[model samples]
Target: MDPSIVREIHQIVPENRVFLDLQERYSYSYDASFGEYLPDIVIQPQSALEISKLVKLANQHRIPVYPRGSATSLSGGSLPVHGGMVLDMSQLKQKCIIDRENLLAIVSPGVTTAEIHRKAEEAGLFYPPDPSSSHISTIGGNLLENSSGPKGLKYGTTKEYVIGLEVVTPTGEIVRTGGKTVKNVTGYDLTRLIVGSEGTLAIVTEAILRLIPKPPARKTMYATFAEFVTSGVAITNILSQGILPAAMEMLDQQCIRAVENFKPIGLPTDAEAMVIIEVDGHPLAVDEEIERCAQVCKEAGATSVHIARDEQERDKIWQARKNVSPALAQVGPTKISEDATVPRNQIPAMMNRLREIREKYQLNLFVFGHAGDGNLHPTIITDKQNKEEMKRVEDAVSEIFEAAISLGGTLSGEHGIGIMKSPYMEMELGEEGLRLMKLIKDAWDPNHILNPGKIFPQPGQTKVVLTDE
Candidate 1:
């Protein structure tokens, strides 16, 4: 970058907020996902006005501008792949207002999802899009990825709660989409378009999120099955019986053993699979629903069923589920986590296909995810240092995507089509369909100055390239 450009940026934002040193720039290079491309400059804009000015400058210079939040993106959503300038949105945390009168929470993009949940609960309201990384991820990133966790089966993803947004367009124009009302069909639904766009379309500065009354009571239960197929059957039985759980999570034997070894959670390591189910509603309703869920599990061939006697027991069950990622980290240096989701009925078939891929590749692939919603996370634990094993891992990942699409599923459920999945977009969306999406991108960003080298694949790119060398 030219010294004149840096001086102009300093004029737009404070000199203290502009970071041009190589060390400071390196911190913005990578995200939670693998790969690293250091941005030429890192700017912490504290207001939408600052962002608008910075964006205008970027557009004038044709510099790629990557908007980033807390950097907790699992799909490389916030990685500075093109590496021109990184707009650190985390420093824009100024607003988080819970409008109890309208059942809405107006928040800045930098507010953590967990903080919104806490404030909403304090006000007798609920924001239900709880991704696993909510404790650390920003609301901006969550909206961009449209990420949801176990509760997606019942409450839907982040897009469902977002009613309005204040965004800076790719060309540096500030625009507001939607409004506070839930029934706004005024114009093009740009709000939904921008959300889940993975920051390619625009940068979200603020959002108005819809909230519902918190559930009065909730019940949790844990079940272990001798076979994964039996666990899948139990999930189908529970939902088939008209019992909609708040969350239904499944963990395979490998994950169970990993968690047990990590923290001694007392899980049944011998079991082929374990499931945790939770129902939330009126106290009396939840009590009856939990019992019905337990009976359904037993009928589906569960070897053991444990209903939580209290909140501590409930936390114990959930804690084990939460420990999965950390436990798996202990197994290998590299973890390639893929969220391939299918229709609820096809989960069993997908699970079987995943087992086949695991065995065929001879890799340590573990399976777990939200069973009720058919979003299974098939994670491969391996060392990227081993070129031979990484080649197999790459093939296994391709097969996994093919298996999910073949089973009438998607390549990703919550994780957006970041750089990792961009190469496979054509496989999922036909050529014409992909072309239409590109048209939208071209119309919105003519210069291709915002978040370049993401979502849309480069020429001749067809598969994931995992070897860093």
Candidate 2:
């Protein structure tokens, strides 16, 4: 970058806030994705006005700006492949309640998801979206990508929880959409449009999210299955029996072992698969639901089941589930998590194909996710240095995606199709859909200044812009 631009940014913001050193820039280069590429500059803005000035400056210089939250992303969504400025938003972390009686919390984009949940808890309210990365991921990025979690089974995804948005347009124009009211049938629904734009449309500055009353009491259970298919079947049976557990997660043999190895949480290592189910409601209602769920699991071929005798046992049951990603990371440095979701009843078929893919690729795999929602994160751990082995893993990923599409599923359940899945996007959405996406991208960013080289591909391109230009 020219020294003039750096000087201008310093004039607009501050020297200490704008990071240009190679070492600091290197740290900001990558997210949770396997790929890494440093940005030309990383600027931390403390206010929307600071960001407004920075965005306009970057646009005037024809610099691609990558707006990042907590950088806990898996799809390289936060990677600045264009070598332009990365507008780090973690500094814009201020949060305050706009109106509590109206159940609205006004928060800056950089606030962690976990903080929002804790705030809601204090107010006798609840925020349904709880991504596993809630402790690290920001509310801004969650709204940007429309992230989901186990709560999605009952409360829907982030987009559903978002009622309004405050966005900084590519040209530095600030705008607001939706409002405090629930049934605002307002114009355009841009709030919904930008909810999952993945930082390509605009940078979210603040959000007005909806909150529900937290459940009274919760009970968690562990259902052990001799067969993976049986666990999937048990999930289907429980949902069909009208026993809506607070959360229903399934872990295959590989996931269980990986978690146990990482954190010895006293789980049955011999079980082929384990299903962690939870119910939260009135004491009497929960007891009845638990009994029904247990019966359904038994009928669906569970080898054994354990209902928590107390809250202590309950925490132990969930500890294994919580340790999944870190545990899988212990196996290899590069952990690629795929979010392919099929229909509720097709989970058995999906799990079966997953095992087949793991065997065919001959790689370390961990499969676990919200079984109630049919969203499974089949993680593949590998050493990227081995080109030939990675080729096999790529083939296996392609096969798994094909199976998902064949079974009426999309490529991503929560994680957006950033650069990671851009190559095979046409296989799923085809030429016409790709053109429509391009048209939308062009409408939003006529100059292609917004986060470019994502979602869609230009023909004959080697990659989805893997390096800083």
Candidate 3:
């Protein structure tokens, strides 16, 4: 709120992009996390140069700046902590260079993941990482979170597809890492490090993403199980059989019924769990794999298996999965979704223990996620305004994190340990492990102004030495 800082903001970005109006600033106060923190100012920079200038001014004054793209994150990663300024990246949307020969594309941070997919399809190439929030989440936010979607099991996550980056570090120094070319390891893989820093390391300006040829054929299969464990067993059996599916997802009966309310997609209503598997390749190859997967599903004790006959049916199947998030959300005004991932083989045990917790806490919880990779999104729906209920939800979430670690799993699979998971990070990684993290963070961001109060806990609260002796 300083006069000089206000002047610098206007000087950097155009007057039209800067909003000092209280009502407008109030609108940028929260994200999809159901959390709120009103920022004092909101800046929508039109270009990378403008962004750098604003960052410089914010850092100089030690004002907290939260970088947000679409603000569709599940965790409160984009929520402003100290309430200074929010750098809205949505206005910086731009996509160019659909280089088919190089199999890559250059895009601004504000570009949505789905936008890139549509553009890439026009160029006959494919950019594969498809987070469930692809329609609303921005490319920069996806990079910061290292988001993974259904196809992540086969194509890999954001870290694998990001070839290079043009990022502005916390000090407002714009630095470029990597290039359009793929497969380069001349030194430390800093590009990968920045990929999932959740905006704490830097503000990604633009990105160069790796693209592969679009698959010629894809077949989808849905199987219902009498028991949830059997569904999980099917996932492990398929992978153990050396059949890499493009996507293998699972949803318990509660999740299925939620989706069935508004639009019935022929999903088994009485089934304990359901598994949706997709295989893609050449026509002959895809067909053979689909048949092989069907056999594996049966061996794992599936009650019935249904394979989509055409593209229309395929879309319908995915539609159900896409709506699964919103469907489970209806249980309460606020949905608390956590990403607890165990190894593929341990998925059955994880799912069983989750059910036990739900019964113990008397929670009406619904569980679903990418079963192929053992990442589950156990959603706890509750009215955030209900203080008593909220406390119970918090305890359940803490226990869930501890349970995941006890199963030899980590706290998060895709969603980073933002403000929501930072407190519980020690449960998974002890003080010694966290110490090493802080050392690296301090080396890059000495001021701790960029997306401060994220990833790790506050200073003095952590045993991690910020200095290199």
Candidate 4:
């Protein structure tokens, strides 16, 4: 960057806020996802006005501005692929107010999701979008990805709770969409548009999130099935019986064995599958619902059903499920996690397809996810350094995407389409559909200076190629 450009940026933001050291720039190079591209400069703007001015400067100089939170994205959502200036949004942590009267949370982009959950619960209110990385990820990242976790089966995603936003548009204009009220149908739903835009549409400075009353009580149960297919049947039966569990998570035998190996939890390693179910509401209703769920699992060929009698027992059951990620990390050097979701009824079919793909590719693939919502995480554990093996892993990944699309599902349920899944955008959304989305991007950022090389595929790119260049 030119010295004049740095001087202009320093004018907008203080000299201390602008990071130009090589080592400092390298820290903002990559995110949780694959690949790394160092930015020319890194800026930490604390206010919306500062960001607005910086964005205007970016447009004037045709520099790509990538707004980033904690960089916990599984997809390459925050990677500075274009190698311009990276705007670290984690420093803008000033606002986080709980509007108890309106049941809303007005928060800054730097506030962690876990903080929001803690504050909401403290006020006797609830925010249900709980991603696995909520403890570390920022609300800005969650809003951009529209991420949700187990509670999403009933409570919905981050997009549902967000009612308004204070955004810096691509053209450096500060705009406010929606308001404190939940019911707003004024015109274009810019709030929804920007919520899941992956920072391609605009930069969010602050957000107003809607909240609901916390549930009074909850019950939990765990069931082990002799066969994976039977576990799917058990899920279908539980839902069919009108017992809408707050969360219905399933794990394959590989996951069970991995967990048992990592930390002995007395889980049935021999069982083909296991599901942990939970229900929340009034005490009596939760008790009855959990019993119904246990009964359905038993009838659906579950080998064992364990109902939690106390909070400790419930936490024990959840602990086994939470151990799956770390346990699987022990299997291989590389973990390619894909969340290919299908229709609720097609979960069984999707499982079958995954089995075939695993056997055909001869790769160590483990499956688990929010079964109640049909979002399965088919993670492939392999060494990326092995060229031949990575080829098979790439093929397996492509097949998983195809299986989900064929079953009338999407390429991603929670993870946004960063560069990793951009190739398959047209496969899921036809050429015309992808074009319409590109049109929206073009209209929002005419200079294409915000988080380029994401969500849209380059010309003639049709498959995922993970091998070295």
What pairs collide in candidate 3? none
Residue-level lDDT tens digits of model 1 in 309-348: 9999999999999999999999999888899999988988
Q: What is candidate 2's lDDT per residue for 1-469, written digit by digit as tens?
A: 8999999999888888888899999999888887787899999998878888888888789888999888877787888977898989988857857467888778889889998999898988888899999999999989988999988888889999888888888888888889887788867888998998889998898899988888888888889888888888788888888888879988988888888889887777888899999998788899889888988889988888889889999888888899898898899877888898898888889888988888888988778999999998888898787777777777777777888888988888999877787777877788899789878878877777777766665568533332233
Clashes by residue pair, model 4: none
Model 3 misplaced regions, further than 4 Å: 459-469
lDDT of 3 by residue, 1-469 (tens): 7777888787788789888888998899888777677888899987788888888887788888799999887778998878888999988857656888899989899988999999999987888999988888899999999999889899899999998999988888889999987988878887999999998888999999999999988999899999988888788888888999999998888999999985787788899998899999899999999999999999989999989999998898888888888787666787888899998888888888888889878887888999998889888887777777776777788778878888899888998777778877676779888888888888887878888878786654432211122
Q: How many residue pairs clash in each candidate?
A: 0, 0, 0, 0
Q: Is candidate 3 or candidate 4 better by lDDT?
A: 4
lDDT of 4 by residue, 1-469 (tens): 8899999999999989999999999999878766678999999999999999999999999999999999988888999988989999988966789999999999999999999999999999899999988999999999999999999899999999999999999999999999999999999999999998999999999999999999999999999999988998999988888878899999999899999999998998899999999999999999889989989999999999999999999989999989888898899888788889899889989999999999999999999999999999999988988999999999999999999999999999998898889999999999899999999999999999999999999888888887884
Model 1 ranges with Cα > 4 A deviation: none
Worst lDDT window (10 residues) for model 1?
A: 28-37
lDDT of 4: 0.93
RMSD of 1: 0.8
* Candidate 1 accuracy as TM-score: 0.99
Per-model TM-score, in order, reads: 0.99, 0.96, 0.96, 0.98
Residue runs of model 4 more than 4 Å from their true location after superposition: none
